[model samples]
Target chain A: MHSWVDGQPVDSVPLKDRGLAYGDGLFETIAVKAGQPLLLDRHLQRLNEGCRRLALVADHGVIRSEVLAYAVALGDGILKLILTRGDSLRGYGLNPGAPVRRILQGSAPATYPPAHGVEGIRLFPCATRLAEQPLLAGLKHLNRLEQVLARAEWQDADHAEGLMLDMSGRVIEGVFSNLFLVRNGLLLTSDLSRCGVAGVMRAELLAQAQALGIPVVVADVSVEQLRQADEVFVCNSVYGIWPVRGCAAMSWPVGPLTRKLQGIVRALLDI
Target chain B: MHSWVDGQPVDSVPLKDRGLAYGDGLFETIAVKAGQPLLLDRHLQRLNEGCRRLALVADHGVIRSEVLAYAVALGDGILKLILTRGDSLRGYGLNPGAPVRRILQGSAPATYPPAHGVEGIRLFPCATRLAEQPLLAGLKHLNRLEQVLARAEWQDADHAEGLMLDMSGRVIEGVFSNLFLVRNGLLLTSDLSRCGVAGVMRAELLAQAQALGIPVVVADVSVEQLRQADEVFVCNSVYGIWPVRGCAAMSWPVGPLTRKLQGIVRALLDI
Candidate 1:
């Protein structure tokens, strides 16, 4: 995460940045290595579409240019880009005329989960439920209290993730990633058209699955269906692919397809 | 407003404040004058409950003392107090071991909506729909993009507020305040057990009406009901009572009961 604000690095942001005020912002966490941002275009595209969906103004070309310049200087690390609607006189109503702010702060050492693309992760079903709001389903806005609470449900750092369910106990996604299950010789994942982050890696996994000619079903899933799966895995742009094993009690081994997907993504990183 | 972090006026906070990260925070905007905060306890109660619900660790008395000290220094303005889960290492999980944060920052020159409590406001139905999540129903956490986009539905300065509907097309709340309508002398407002802010003023109005022998019903309302109302008004602790003159060409006047409630709130404010 190279630090830059509107193209310059700043140590602090105004406390009242609309991101703070209304969670009125978009963010993209890109995987970085050696010194370059991976899947940069995909992250930027989602960020732009997010801004458009919320009617926030940001020049994709300008932000992209700045990100590249900033990353080149920082060497290897993850990049987290946060763009907020700048300070406005206190009000819920938009200052349609207000300038949207760009907060490019924090360039930290990029570290992947130690078990990533290998031994995999363990997840527990969380009692905290996510609301179904299609308007906010896919956009990576800053209003993330649900994820915070759901993740906080467990204190064991060994558990890498928590699978959140909606009010009806329908499976949604991991706290930060999308979920996929292999059952009955088919590939299935929860549809995020209602509530969850539309992760960049999840998008790639879907595309690659289609290219592989696998049977993929995007629909509502229940805990019962998840429990009966032969294999399970979670994915996000930063983590790439992580198999899920022993979701508290049920266990799953890293499957063949999960490994093949990981190989292609690894090749991209090595490139 | 006076600026403080855990009772001290700090020059800067860590860039990693949870309020900025996961928006793991809660805030209260109060109308203050003559070195006193209006309905301070209600605001404090909401903030305290939010902190507990979000698993944030903090002493309530400390927050009370800090906010009071800051409010006393500023004779008039809006006091915005934010209690966040505080800064932590990278993860969606809460910092169970992290110290809580209290952000007391606002300008003393700030005033409530000019037309809100005086001449009332005009509103229009918003197209953005809120999702029903009982788990997150009324706590005013920082996940407010739903309201942000709804508030952005228009940019007219004269249009003081916009009324929001749930995905089911049921009327819920204004962008910030609670909604109320009068029909046949019955006081009606949207039930927020599923959506919208459980506003401080709305609670007080309910209590005030109950004490005054007026009937209050928390029920599902529709646009037609709003359009057919004899009178309409919106309220929040900051702006006591704002009458609605029109909502999408439907005209209403300041109802007799609304004016009476306004007088009651004004009396309390003068205290």
Candidate 2:
């Protein structure tokens, strides 16, 4: 693991990193393919946007260059970027001009989730609900206890992921990925303006579907709507996309839309 | 700082500690006075309840012993108790049987907000609002970006704390403390069952208020409500109760109720 405190390597962070204190940080996980970070520009864009929203500095070019360097050294692995509001003397009030830190760390030979891309996978409808707060929504910050607790609901390996519902009982997304369902030729996914991660892969798929003339609807979804959908799939930057074969007992047949999306992501990432 | 992982002294934690990853952990910042923890039992109760909500673990005696042993030699300072579901192979999913790790770090004397328990404070209403999610509303888990971002809004040392409102513009509390207002003999504040921190001090004040025959109403409060308030104050475990002299342009006076509550807290913590 490599880290930079105020842009310099450090043995340990001051125990008061806002990231650990109040999760006052943003992160990005990317796939390192053939010494290249897949969707590097897009990841940097999101990271920059998050920092901008929080009024933190955005050295887009430096972050992009540094992350690529770390990924290339690993040959083939996962790259994670964590940018935090450095340290404070003590208290919730910000110390103007406090140095910010960037941490680039991950393991080599990133293991993709099962061969479910070909065989498809199952999902469980978890009882845990994702909380909605637009101020901290979309951007992937470290405040992920909701996801951690939701994912802990069950440990069924067969179920590749668990579907999380929002406080309104609307199906939002999966534990670590975004959910999409095709019904009557329209692609449906939860709106991240409320809850759920705005996954880079999910964004890519949305653009691809728009170019393909497939209607994409971003709104609330009920369990019944998911059960009646023609097909379902969950996606993330790492796993590309995995078709949902069965949710509990209801099953999906891996429709044309699902397969096309998988192919598009593969071509985009050259996985 | 003294620290440990799985009972052995460690230099740093795996970057994947759920604590740093998702704030998928519970923590208690206790005031260690005279080599002993102040309000130890109360802090443990809150930590235990948070663990149950996240379904982590709660062997109170075990954690208590660990904290005491590490804090015995320490004089006046603060002890942070971070309990995270031990390491997992990098996923949001929790292993029900995952070992829980305790991180006990020490800090030197605290420098609290100036004018504390005295001249009162001036606050700014922050645009970043806390979301009302009854499930994770009160527990002081790791998911606190909203507060951190709000706190980062300014650097005016004399400005004191920032007031956080919900998305609907309803006044919630400060970035770190529970707010209380006295108006026409009634002490009112926002309810934590839906949003805001259930500060350890706030809870004690409620019980003490009942004993003193003070009417403490926990309900939704708005900016207008605060403007009409006669007196206002904020409290947390470490800060006891600090009166509010002004909020941006609107001003408030320190009332008898605010002083009475602070007197009770001083007697309790023996500050």
Q: TM-scores of all models?
A: 0.92, 0.91
Best by DockQ: 1
lDDT, each prediction: 0.80, 0.80
Interface RMSD of 1: 1.7
Tens-place lDDT digits, model 1, residues A57-150: 8777788887777677767766778888877667776675668877665467646666656799888778889998888888898888888878
Interface RMSD for candidates 1 onward, in order: 1.7, 2.2
lDDT of 1 at B132: 88
Per-residue lDDT tens digits of candidate 2, residues B89-116? Answer: 6678665566887877777867775566
lDDT of each residue in B56-79, candidate 1, tens digit only: 778899888877777788777878
- Among residues 3 or more apart in sequence or in different chains, the pairs in candidate 2 whose N, CA or C atoms overlap within 3 Å are none
Q: What TM-score does chain B get in every candidate?
A: 0.94, 0.94
